[model samples]
Target: MRSFVTFASAFLVGLISFTNCTKRTSSTATQTGGGMAAEQQLAGDDLTKARANYTNFCGGCHGRSLETFVNRKWQHGDSPEALFKGIKHGYPDQGMPSYDTTFTDQEIRHLVSYIREGIVAQKGKTETKSNAAVLKSEKLNFQLDTVLTGINVPWAMAFLPNGDMLVTERSGTLYRFTKAKQLQKIEGVPEVLAQGQGGLLDVKLHPDFSKNNIIFLSYSAVKRDGGQTLSTTAIMRAKLEGNSLTNQKQIFEAQPYARTRHHYGSRIEFGRDGYLYFSMGDRGGTKVNPQNLSVHAGKTHRIKEDGSIPADNPFVNRQDAMPSIYTFGNRNAQGMALNPTTGDIWLHEHGPKGGDEVNIVKKGANYGWADVTHGIDYNGSKISDLNQKDGITDPIKIWVPSIAPSGMAFVTGDRYSGWKGSLLVGSLSFKFLSRLELDGNKVVREERLLQDIGRVRDVRLSPDGYVYIAVENPGIIYRLVPVSN
Candidate 1:
């Protein structure tokens, strides 16, 4: 399983729940207090009530046994509050709910206790719930009482004018979420090619969405290859009419034989420069295209949002090289960000075995993976001792014990005043959100949050002052809300 399980529980005792994901920033040891929040005055049953409320309201989507280690985080792991803030202010466009007004603080408390105790229970198989306040980070904190559950696996979501949202499930289903906290499935949607990792992958609106009503999607489309075993990733542009994708046009298709159910590394971000940056994952095997200097696989490419490469692309002079190649030599890079202050591309990719990395993506630079890596050979075998040595570029930061880095986002909201200039990497392995402070192109320090918030797959900052995250299967989209001023 290509997952990032970076935390070592056997050696870590009583560590609080935290978000853990690897990102490109220099590594510096954290010296903040390792402690839980103060035990505030509360009803003895607060924990129980919170637990029951979550079970009753959340189980509808996250699975009946939602506490069964979605990311398998063990003892001394991250905690549940990470999910709390998210549940209170869900990514309405993703079909999730908010209990901000539906439940009281006492009820939220019970839920946090239940989740914390549940993590401990997994280690012993038999343990009674305790009454201690769960631990949290001093610099970064999570809301424990709220939980993000019951949202279907949405392919993409777009916020509405009033801060509500419209989300499309990968299975070709669309839903509407209102600010009043109601989730209703929209009636029509284009049929998605839902096979593997290729379905309705990403959904974005034109910068003038309010006026043009334009939307775009990245999905795999079935393409006949001899018999019945092929499809390819394609980018389509369409306009939203009510709840359906209408007049969708195929703007881009990976060259022929782009038929893989997996490794459809598709993510499109509109740069402040008015260009679009797209990522394509390595199609399965250790080798394919990007590194070949002849294909676009496993690379971050730049193109006009209209799908044309700029003439000045680094490799435009070469016939075999794909003009979209911004940086090459990547494998399954899922997280991407453009720093709010500097506008540099921040990218994170899954590392084999170990050595997950966060890198300040530079144009035309080669990021060595199979060719150059800090990782051991899969199957625990030894490989070249190529870490910070080879001519291959080095990662700004790496997890010796892989954290299976997934999604990424910059901290721009006021809720995270201390983390204003930092980046958050969502970890599928460590099951928490990892924080990094940057000094221009370098990372300076690191910290972890939500010791138990397992397998954070996606981190997104809403236009509003909220941080939303997605945890894979029994998957859910959650929100980080600020406390009242």
Candidate 2:
């Protein structure tokens, strides 16, 4: 297993803390409040067993400390009975599977006890949860500035030669952010599904946007006639004439449209090799999609700028495989960027509970996702028994208890002195920017910036070398400036 410097301390701040584990008792247990049974019986052996159980199953999603439960006010009740019921029945609609048959009532009680006593007790040992203090104490040199505000779920962005930016939202809207900090809704965008995780996603200009004036858009296109409607990620090319888009043409669409609306890996980038590359996630087809090559689901695809499959594509000659498939077995790779020096494709994907991964994508490689993973299922079940097997590429970095990585950009400009070559990865769950300092392809160190900001949806460097970011929740954009040492 690859070892990583975990941000474990960062997870503990801003939550409830306890000094004595023995006084806390679960409602489901036969013990009374602060009684002799609570101190003698439930303190030692039961907690150890509960912690072990949590690590084996729940830790992947909830973290070993049950961080998500600690950080959020529970919609389901916080009582032991409510927690036990939630754990037993599970919430399949919300990606958590039922554990009714998996664990007994006692085990579920143990989990609740662990949450109340073991996990919540670890908070406030430190004075603050603010990342500002974390950054200041670390003495990192950087400055964050708010660029634009009142935007909605800004998903992806691309810069133009004139310093203006084109951005996409998951709600089927497009906007152009000007150098003067003005926002204009671009006209003539296609109708999108805009449901669940679907909608207008990524926006990028053609590599030669200076001459062609072509902009590329990735969105969830709906196929509807009377009642039934299905949606899939599609790439469209349009001509940008001032604030309006003209000559719009869809270039590529992932095949076999599904009804599910999550996990559309729609990041697009132009490789140095002059091929247009885009990612299509597993589309919630975990068992069948990632392993199959005949379908485009859960795969990275490459095509010409005009949407034709590249003849030199990895699976072009395979009769049983889709010709556009450049690589297979990916699980929702939302972050992708070309390394500035190496020209290699670096991608970060969402794993089940804890196994978010960053991998250097190579041609025709299988990135083992339902078959092998470091994460378990949402219901605290194992997705696969093994983390590694033959023929699967291992990620260079894995974020345990997932950060929900989103947009990514390689730092290319000298405006930030020490960060010129680092990779900035946005996080939706943790609401921070992870600066990965790379030694060749391996991540040597990581610095989390702008923590507790809105969920970072996209990170892009402009032509002028300034770092621009899109933040969701209250939707806004911000720029990063270098601080002098």
Candidate 3:
């Protein structure tokens, strides 16, 4: 596991320091006298058990002090029964699994009771019965929790059929969350570069997860500098076992890495045709870096499942020109998603300073980044009118000030019937999830969710119908629950 720095003070900041955890709009928990004073008991074997449980099951991801989101008001002051249901049901899709079977009712109650006591104390309240059925806190308008806290910066999540979730932290940590949400840091993931924006980044499960149990990971791998003086970018594939990764293989790697410290576009998805679609950044430089077909940077790549280039690729059977290049002319497009409905890839990339773009990814096409953009250069020089012409693909939507959109997922579940067809786009610079109403290929309506939450990095739909958002700050994942229409 890469040593991602963690501080216990992050816990105090995440929870109590914030006034509340309810979605800025509405909430479900209630803050009132309906529940008795909050108090908790932890002694002898009980204390030992809770500590052991947290250590063995959760310590790896949540940190020694459970700092991540433990400080949030919503995490504390929940009634035991409410806590039980939340833990028992497991927010699998959100990366919080239920641990009801592994832990007894008493243990859960005590654990939850302990959490409530901390909050009650924070609120300066007295002690009473261990209320189990009352409101967990104030009614929650949205769903938010500190799913797991201690792991290295968790980058992405993939759900299993049993409502379990496997998450990858940026610093090469792989962890498993039970359905009840007890996080266990899994061992045996291959060693990652863990340096300068180059650790494990994204993980997506095979569509037929139940049958294959196969998973894919994208990261920057270190390689010899060749005759020159730099490294390279490489993506690896692996099969995940209980606590380890097996058959690790490097499927793709870039030639001659940049001396700079950033920009390695690594997002992977299986297309409708069964070809693997992936991308690579331009290795951080200005002027036609990735757009050049002769080079490997700044390209949307396509390949076979086993790391072989497809014969029918855009440049099929070509020599120097990369046959894997599906498209070019991009800046750092960190997020890519296949329209679960249209079989088309929707791409969001960070454009020049302010012109962040959302584009319908095209095959064998170029998206004008340095050549034409609605944004200004770092020192401020306007590029283009965001026109649609010539050989460049126009973006479907562009943010003027730039929200720095990271990851996006189309809402397809019934949990929030109103948002069923909307796109949940998590914006890191904006610290919110932008909901875009989709009318076929057109985006019609837009709303920003979780304005109060920290930097939202990614969003996805849970199999159970809810949406999960990954926030980077203290690094937490929150679930959005709709209490009202």
Candidate 3 per-residue C-alpha lDDT over 184-239 given as tens digits, one digit per residue, 9 for 90 to 100: 78766656665444567778787776787777788766544655434345667777
Could you estimate the TM-score for every candidate?
Answer: 0.69, 0.77, 0.69
User: What are the lDDT scores of the predictions, listed in order?
Assistant: 0.58, 0.72, 0.60
Tens digit of per-residue lDDT, candidate 1, span 259-363 = 445556566677777777766666554445546767766777777767888876788788888777788877667677889898877788766556678876777
Best by lDDT: 2
Count backbone clashes in candidate 3: 31
Model 1: weakest 10-residue lDDT segment is 7-16
Query: How far does residue 65 in candidate 3 sit from its true spot (Å)?
Result: 24
* Residue-wise C-alpha lDDT for candidate 2, range 344-428, written one tens digit per residue: 8888887765678898878999988778888755444456787898999888998876777788999886687677688899876
> Between candidates 1 and 3, which one is better according to lDDT?
3
